[model samples]
Target: MKAVLPSITSDLDQAERDLREHGICLVSGVLSAEQLADVRAGLYRAAKLDNRRKLAHSGRRIDHGESNQHVRNTLSLDPVFADVAEHPAALRLVRSVLGWPALLGNQSAFIAMPGCEAGRLHADQGFIPEPWPTLPQGCNVGWCIDEFTEENGATRFVPGSCRHHRPPGEGDEEGSVAAVAPAGTMVVFDSRIWHRTGENRTSDQSCAALFNWYTRPIYRTQENWFLSLNPRILEGASDELLTLLGYKTEGFGKVNGRSPM
Candidate 1:
């Protein structure tokens, strides 16, 4: 595999700044060709695992007819996925946007149905009952494993939608932006931004890995990652990464009572 950058710098700095201001940023070619291949290999491996099954839960389920598959808890399934989850470019961008001391929350793989229709437009952070202007809570990184496009059901977002206090209505004339990129490009955006999965008009299933990050210590993650991790995975992870994955929660006292033991 190719060597990863310690952090994103120079032109990426400007791109990050623009994302912070607009509540969304798209970084093309963030994942190298080798890295992309590794991710694809890992995903295909996970998909083929007998133990790796589809989630029974239907709320987030996509209508795949015979092939609709939504796979979860991938971090524990393979080390290759763990590496991609903690990719340097993704980590650097998360830190730059949310400030230091962020952790991964709600990591999963989305394998969508070819003819699936559009999903409801809503902000991931809307579930939080707290008032506005609070510290930045979380953001999500969408790693395109396959080519994303309007025809293949790419994610749609409304620019500057993060500033809205409530979810957008059905009649709202939202300015839609499709996350169109080749395999390996990653899209990072604030959790507060309004977005939805677009309809898939093609025969191929759209696949992407979703990695969410948060600055606060105590919020419930989108995925229960602790229950999904194993000792071997923990041993191989970096100190910073271990903490991000909830292996060691030092500063988490601000949210969860007492440090994570």
Candidate 2:
């Protein structure tokens, strides 16, 4: 649980090194303030839209910090999100952990509203059976919008716990520390890491944390991009984004009567 925070200004090679050593690396200053502003605007708007829909159907809010919201399938929610999800540095880092042909496994918003409690410590690939700790199937990139202070629910992780190759039980987690960083920092971690959200102690601030998860091309993504993405959004997108959406795979979809490459 000791936090081994490497210098976020390290080059890509060092960043990748930290990922291997600690199972997570907080890359500071990856996103510019302007980029953060654009995404935050879109993110809040999308959250409001989603909140209204959820309110009508569930008669309850998602969480409490300010509507403690976790919005899955954010790739299609806003163009700014899409841009960040496919950012060059993030994709390169994820590909280092997953592979050159990695696909976008999932994208979502994890808003820590004030009073939002910590989530269970877990690996992103928490449910694959029998395979045990086979090969790694994922890597996650957290695009932090607001600064991640211990009091504002910064994620916490156990250093080098990925080597355990199995989930840590409640008794196993000790010395956990928060992955603290300023706003616009990008947190990249191996999916096998033992980590979870920490409690948001603030009374009025809601933290906006966006997660863009990637995995091998063969594994299924959490969000079905084909179904969720608007046709306009998909139309004429760059080849890279298309591939991340699993359009590069042969079995699941075909375009123009031929398999997408």
Candidate 3:
């Protein structure tokens, strides 16, 4: 079967190498059935809220009939997603890629309806200059909510293209491959890799995946966590997650010269 670094059974150094060599990897069994069930329950509740309110208040757009409906600012939505964001293997890889003291850049749910067009094949670092510098900017972890098939928009990406340092060429996609994996898998990819969502070709079908973006802690997050997040969600958060969300008192996240207590 076609694959891209399937279900990492190797050591972490090897997994890190795989991330550099393949620009992506899939770690299997990141979530057990019970945890998955809880996440789904929370996601359904949030999706229903988004669907009803149109996600207008979240500082992100939610078009009524768009092919891809993104539930942005998901960290502030519910607590079950915390399990996915702070997953150990994923954090290890993201920290290795983005360097120590990494931070959560953003998290969201992507629901792709059938016939969704191919997203632009681009690198996540494009927000910076071309020929990206040596330092890693960010990485992405996609928590699969359903079977990710080739025809179900299972993340199309160029293999070994992390070294490209720039946007992909027109012909690069001709060799692109789908990240086919099971529902409970974590799809990890470097921000520099060239990727896009594959078109969903099935009828009366849709696919759902969660994006948990992590970075080197200096970059501005896509969503404003300080103001948007519900304070109640922080009642039982772990220290690692609190830090990832920039609850620390130092650096850019500092509040009025006061540090995180």
Candidate 4:
């Protein structure tokens, strides 16, 4: 199938337009079928490895132990996951959302299966002890690795909710919409928007690769990815890749110190 994306200039213009109108934008076919398959396989392998270790240590019998109550598995453990986390379309979307010079904060995955409970509705940065009515700190890219539908636990968001002084409530239900997209598609949204993972009703599981990039330098990430990076991966990565991975001179200025000129 052909890749679904606008040309670079068109994408930039469209992205800004989308952000101005809608709090989120759905970009389709960011990943090819082969790439999607590879990511899924890598996730499965990671999940299996974790499950095997859990079972071996617990000595308890379990059915489908690989699945979790909220998110089944995380992609941070997979090497190939780094590629998906730094995809070009994803970066463009981030630039549009945050107005560029953004820093990559965290990279992870969420796999939801049937019967999983619905996630709580909250903005990601809320975890930080900050003042109310904060500025837009960052944006997130949710890659639909599996087919996501309303019945299959698609992501739900309140459009233009980012403009609100605070998080939305039950009264904001009218504008909320479920972002149902096909596998290989991606949904990029403001980190401050009110959103939740919808409950999965299908028997099969729904998986998503979530990459969050921040506009500012001080924010903490959901995933401690710096520990996961190795020399091989770093050497092969581009400068943009390194910047996205939190390797920047500005952010480390105080710590790195200035030379005596």
Judge candidate 4 at residue 240 and give its lDDT: 63
Give the higher-TM-score candidate: 3 or 4.
3
- The weakest ten consecutive residues by lDDT in model 4 span 1-10
Ten residues in a row with the worst lDDT in model 1?
1-10
Candidates' C-alpha lDDT: 0.65, 0.77, 0.76, 0.61
List model 3 lDDT by residue over 1-261, tens digit each.
Answer: 443544554366667777877778777766889987887677767877888987723443422236777777777766777778998888898877876677887888877778777777777777887658865588999888877888887777777788767777768777678877777777888888888887888877677788898887778877688888878768888877888888875324666777574
Q: Give the Å error, residue 193, model 1.
A: 0.7
lDDT of 1 by residue, 91-187 (tens): 8878776765676775667655676667667776766775655444677888778887778777777777777755577864357767776677677
If both were scored by lDDT, which would come out higher, candidate 1 or candidate 4?
A: 1
In candidate 3, how many Å is residue 250 off?
5.2
Model 4, 2-68: lDDT tens digits are 2122221235457666765665677765678888898878766665675566632243211123333
Candidate 3 lDDT: 0.76
lDDT of 4 at 154: 74
Top-down lDDT ranking:
2, 3, 1, 4
- Winner on lDDT (1 vs 2): 2
Structural similarity to truth (TM-score) of each candidate: 0.82, 0.89, 0.88, 0.79
Give RMSD (Å) of candidate 2 vs. truth.
3.0
- Model 1 alpha-carbon drift over 4 Å, by segment: 1-10, 50-68, 213-215, 251-261
Pairing residues by index, what is the TM-score of model 1? 0.82
